[model samples]
Target: MTTSNFHGAVGTKAKPVTSQFQFGPWTLTAVKSHILESEGIARQRFEGELELPQVPEMIFADNVLRLQHVAGFGLEFNALDALKLVDAHNDPLKVAVAQAWKEARADCEHINEVVKPFDWTFTTEYKGTLIGKDGVQLKVEPTDERIDLEKLKVREKIHFYEDILLFDDELSDNGSSIMNVKIRVMPTSFFILLRQFMRVDNVVVRVLDTRLYHEAEKDFILREHSYKESKVQDIQGPPHIVTDPNQVAQLLPIKRETFEKLIFPSSSISQKEADAIR
Candidate 1:
């Protein structure tokens, strides 16, 4: 489809993609495929260098494809670098340079394999029954209200590598209105290891609480705006002031002021005015 048609159709689906460099094979592949589809996406994917979980859906889709390369981190030890390091080590001033280069290369290789997946599965350990206040066992009828997650304290144990998410339901013996559900989550440790390639560790857990996660994010953004405003006040005092040329220069980083009254007052001294004052 054309760019306008594609953008209109995709909506938020065409939003930017960020990378942590540590993506599993499937995740990387999906991300790369998304990038290949559009020049804007490709540019964003490479240029953003954003961490994981920042855009949860993008990470999820990309995690399905599995990419194999780090975006900007070029090899520090190509043949040329190797030769230069070897020559430098030959000098009396840099005898350890060669060994240092080898260590650095090894470390980079280790980082490269971080996003690869391994056995990422866990089993649901708890055995229990769900019921309503009416003394009806949930095993008989799976009604949303009877065993609904809203009232139920259901916990889930997720294992990423094994590709299985285990759902656990734990409740109190009492016939209380609320079902005490406990979600015991465990994903393959290797999945975390894969994130290490991108210097990340909490990838799977990061995506677990989507709703609360966004709420917290919104709160953070608001707080950040307040903090920024406070800082601006501290640095610049009250905003309304004479539109002196110097003050206008200081406010350049902010958007240009449309109204002369809203902006700083002019302080430019014309040649005739300066001569008259002198």
Candidate 2:
């Protein structure tokens, strides 16, 4: 694991710190910044055109994972991009939450106040932002490739590891919503998991995961996205599990899944140019 650090400026005028590691042909970087301020939140709300979650101030807008290959292919995971996936259309989940809130606060004087509709649960299915080098066209094609769990289970020396929290909220104490990304590098391969977990009290529990895996010296990477969810009442577990997204995620049933492969070019040439040369 090759490690390095750098500093930059962000909101609150605080210096943002970055940590990175270099492996076979890839560079993995994690950037962490202070929580968003009122000014920052207002700007983001306007720019993103979305109603954010409670405690939006906790969001680390600059926190991100940047994984790049020497060939200029890369992927980025960040809070702003993930929050954009929250329901803009009045989905069932949003409606249900609104109704629940109204019913729970029927006696309150402000119960009838008009409120904008958004995915109160803050669920998102974001995988990652794919990046290609200048003049290169990179696309992830559906493939049969899958990550080898058995191999990952084996004990091996870990070269580098990082867990980055992008954003999190308590859903105004109705439940919780959190998004984070974790990565681990080993001698022969690396794995990344970008996850979004949400729980709406007496409503539902959901988890969306995007996994990326690559072996040393490999010319391609494997990517998988899985979504799982279960009704709050239907989820039978210890009392504590309901509050822990990681624990509840194990009990939720899989609702959808997909796999894809990203192939790297042999040289700096674009795929179209390479084909022409061939």
Candidate 3:
């Protein structure tokens, strides 16, 4: 994806916000915060970061077998962000940032919520498929609707780590950054697929080229050519599938509910709103 510079949002200052995130077995520190300014107006904003542990060789190997392949935002709101938004008196930029923060938290909640973890068996029934060429998909009825596999932009890549003999989901070195606006917005869009595949905690399943969508019915399908395929030679049999999350963590450190929280951040709802919900 290409990023285009936009006007109207001239950045005046950008400093890292102090924040930290704890995911499963790892701890991440806050990098920085920035105060964005436009039209002679400025508001403090926390630049988002994805902090997770480096994947262990074992986990990396596990992911290679199947295919390769955030936080720090609490105290702010509990202290003043909520009241600040209301106090901003509807200043467009301030209100926008406040709402955006809330939305981000909501994203965290949606991903890590308990609705599914306790009953992951329901994920096996999802029929949706994330269509990233030879990437991965859901083989059964979907447990959650947060991610729409069919909606993902299908991009191609070369298999770098394993041989064509090993048929697992091929990781894309597409070089897309998580902070990429599109990904930041729907942070969980990709993981909902993983969550659907994960049956146990601290683990996520990654499969590619296993379920082929056809004129028939429920089965995961992923087919990617290591190289171009001649019309006459429809080489088959390398389509692989692996059910584990270690590989995924190397790329993005997220375990089931934590992952849910990572994407649908609880910050989406403020202490006031949460109190209201309660």
Best model number under lDDT: 2
Residue range 1-278, candidate 1, lDDT tens digits:
00111223265356423222212111211111131222366535632452211111111222121212111111010111111211211222222332332344354433244343211111111122111233321122211221123422333343222121111111111100110111111221111111000001111110011010001001110000000001223334344321222342233233111110111112323324433553
Q: What's the candidate order when arranged by decreasing TM-score?
A: 2, 3, 1
Instruction: Give the poorly placed runs of model 1, Cα more than 4 Å off.
Output: 1-48, 51-278
CA displacement after TM-score superposition, residue 122 of candidate 2 (Å): 1.8
- The C-alpha RMSD of each candidate to the native structure, in angstroms, is 29.3, 5.3, 22.7
User: What's the lDDT for candidate 1?
Assistant: 0.20
Model 2, position 250: C-alpha lDDT score = 86
On residues 248-269, what C-alpha lDDT tens digit does candidate 2 reach at each position?
8889999999999977765644
Q: In angstroms, give how far residue 140 of model 1 lies from its true place.
A: 40
Tell me the spans in candidate 3 whose CA falls farther than 4 Å from its real position.
Answer: 1-146, 154-235, 238-278
